[model samples]
Target chain A: MSTRWLAQPERGNRRLIRLLTWITLKLGRPVARWLLYPICLYFLLFSGRTQRISREYLQRILKRPAGWRDVFRHYHAFASTIHDRVYLLSGRHRYFDIRIEGASALHAILAQKRGCILLGSHLGSFEVLRAHGLFDQQLPITVIMHEAAASNLNAVLHSLHPEIRDHIIPPGTPDTMLAVKERLDQGEMVGILGDRVFGDEKGMTCDFLGKPRMFPEGPFLLAALLQVPVVLFFGLYQGGRQYDIHFEPLADSIHLDRVRRSETLRPWIERYVSRLEHYCRLYPYNWFNFYDLTDDARPSHTAV
Target chain B: MASSPQLGFTTASGLEQDLAKLIVDSLRLEVAPGDIDPAAPLFGDGLGLDSIDMLEIALAVSKRYAVELRSENRAALASLRALAAHIAQQRTS
Candidate 1:
């Protein structure tokens, strides 16, 4: 049902969402924490399938005995994270406290005036990038993502935030490839969600946590072709409306033979997995990936 | 049929036997290495593995073989045999 809202015409809700973003900006985050309860309830009551899937992932990934309390905590935290991400895009980071560790490293890369690939995962609010984007006015960021298959709420946000929607590149097709290449040639950075599966075989086999998972190699492969430095980025939600942004240099732009270039990608994948593992260990609730696609029993598009 | 490492085998064949054990343990498969006829299929006929299962196997092979599987190297036809050759090369190198 919510999927219908995603494809709904945006004109009617444009004003409403703009007003919501303003109200969110004004009210501040402490007052914002109150919204978590009802949002938590909505997931518990409304999304029977999603809640079950999350629980299953938590159970397998955690790989230890977890009581109902632990399970409920994950439910509450997941709900809370979603609510916070909404506030974040509306300028919550400025008013609320955010600890950023590696902005300078990114700035240094941007200073080079060469293209860069910034990789971030779904462990926290990728929206934090919007704050940096709007503030720094640095190189433009092209984000590669799967087109949302559901969630009208996300659709509304995307449409309202044209900055986000326009910059996001959906999987497949040569057009997006040309766009990314264009951005690279112009000395801009491209961002990608390296964790999710596009279900294509065009990804590298990676050991995520202790298990082997298929992670997209598109960004790294792109970096090699364009001869750009690949920088790894982490934006994690800290407690109480706060986030910590970290950046690491995966590799310097270097001339490489074909074989050397592909092997070069290994360190970048290792760095991303290492950083992602840290966040996952601390905030198990916030890593919202449904690892086993089989458990994703969300009502199908045909069913809707 | 795999030339049995259980009795005695060629060195390259031994590497193949070891890789089979690594795959079974890493994926926690129900079948043993010797039980998995190297010529037998990995998908519907033999082990009934899917792509997801293949990914799991690929990761295990990458780690133990000290070889990285790149984006271009993925194809269903390049299943156990391709993986065995990759491991053999990595071991020799």
Candidate 2:
């Protein structure tokens, strides 16, 4: 059970990503999106791991035997989200019709003059949230990411639009906490992907879907220490040029005492996992953790 | 800038030792306070700690020193020497 998502080889290179970006911008979305079918087919035929993982995820979410078509749809959804990123990155959000659910809750949070942790997952287009940032000047958003994975593609994306690169806070660096803290101090939004744990990072086993899966303790711990409000953001790919951006408040404030910090944090994590599961049901093809998430046999103690 | 110099205990080595003890007790590590190298990394290969441990240390520091260590304090968190210095400088007590 390879729980490590970062260890997996990058699917596309810098050249491919740049080419897709160029073609998408030059040819426009509709024609560029037609290219996703062949790309999805390429993965469906060649990437056996992606196919099997897609089936595994689809089976659990769909609650039925997932067939090749379902897997294809899953791949297509992922590819489409990636394609939309080209537009989103370039500040061309007019192409997609994004309906933001819970805008009131978001506005209310922003009303309070405190920074927040925008906990996002890989379920949908995170770029969609950034797209919202482009239009809305009030919501200053920054993403916390592991820059090592897909360095080449990230470099390409950064080169295309340096503003996107400016908003990134890479984890594990000495300045990561400083960057997060500085942004939060300015009453700005700091986004972090709560789904995937990196190599040797401490994680906690929680009931996700129906089985126990390891969820990284880092993000939750950061929230707890900072004692800030946390909001769950999910941008689901509805299909074609439509998306649903959902924002729900996960916690008013995360405070874990030293005595039973682990015990206290467990419920908060479970609630988050349950919400993620609920969203996965709504958009069955959106959940994209490609690793063996159901592998409960991995010793829980290995996290630290 | 560390402004809390009124506590009067100004020895850097002494503060480092105190922080080492605090870390061990807070994280429940098996190592003795003296065993922790002041210059060694608190994360990854040195102490083999993760974000949770770091947060634990932060919480403990906050409670003990009445200092809220924000993310901007990350540079000062890299080693025990640095963290101890930051805590001493920031400690309201």
Candidate 3:
């Protein structure tokens, strides 16, 4: 799979990011959000690659040619989520109308004291879920991520809420799986974004949004190894201070036979991609992967 | 410690050899089992293994020896010899 996404540089520098953060915190959200319009306009005019990608993705999912306004709205949705992160991280969730669906099912799984994997994508705001973990039921959610992917942005965001640093588990470290296993053993929820492929990790190509897209196999492999239930979550930005967090049960346990590893994993990935597609169609503007997902040169392998 | 009846002369002990083979097989490493240094690190520069390999080794060890490896016991993953000792100690305990 193409690793182009990894090489994509952070747009703004640290000084600019810190300045924005400072403004967002000092001026309050209402005054701070006005800054996004100019910022979005700057990106739309200057970031040719991202703008083209946004247009293409919107067209594919919308089933119609995306005009400049559609692309602008897409960028605005993304910027809104990023802006909300400051409030969510600073414990100001009351400012927004956050509605949660299928939360009772999640509570039931947690009540069993057997931790499950909360698999998410780049669809919407993950910070909303973090807010839920922080204020709501006090759900112990640890995020597994590739830290080096967006170091500049992360550095700025981490500074906003220093406490969140403790909750992140970067993959590829020797202690990564052990840490994840320990957390699961303690009945703590582990959150992983399974849409993007990183490094040389194996990826399985599945039909998504009318084309084959490669998804990292590492998350599913970890789930199979840990023998835990898997749950799907999507924190969709419903525009104008409204965020809908949805959770659904995915698998009781993913068992991959050694002989038929890819075959067993196929259905799981397909189910995930289909659910992601359903949501993307439902809320077309909420998709946040800013790169060409279906442009992989790797030959698609059918399950044996 | 000198020799084993099942296999011919070998430098590593039976447990260490078993663990080494398990590591090579599970990770599908091109190196031979005997080539791996028992005292060298299993991850990073030594074996060039990553977190995924660690989990793969852990799964293999649990299935073969029925000993569970935990994050708290990170020292056990220091080297092949250390891992073998940890497994033997756990099995006995």
Leading candidate by TM-score: 2
Q: Weakest 10 consecutive residues, lDDT, candidate 3 chain A?
A: A1-10
Candidate 1 at A72: error in angstroms?
A: 3.5
lDDT of 2 by residue, B1-93 (tens): 133434455688987887788889878899999999999989878898765567667767767666777666777778998888887767644
lDDT of 1 by residue, A175-266 (tens): 44555655666788888776764533245666776667666656665665557888877777676666777777777764435445447667
Model 1 residue A172 CA deviation in Å: 2.0
lDDT of 3: 0.80
Distance from true location, Cα of A7 in model 2, Å: 10
Alpha carbon lDDT at A43, candidate 2:
71
**Cα TM-score of candidate 2:** 0.87
lDDT of 3 by residue, A1-304 (tens): 1112112324346677778889999999889999989877776677777778788889898889999899889988988888888788888888899899988999899888889899999899888998779766578898986452356666777677787877788776677888888888899999988787765567888887878888877778888978888999999999988999999999888998876787888889889998999999998999887757666643221100
User: Fraction of native contacts in model 2?
Assistant: 0.26
- Every candidate's lDDT: 0.59, 0.76, 0.80
Residue B58's lDDT in candidate 2 = 70
Best by lDDT: 3
Docking class of 2: acceptable
**lDDT for residue B16 in candidate 1, whole number 0-100:** 67
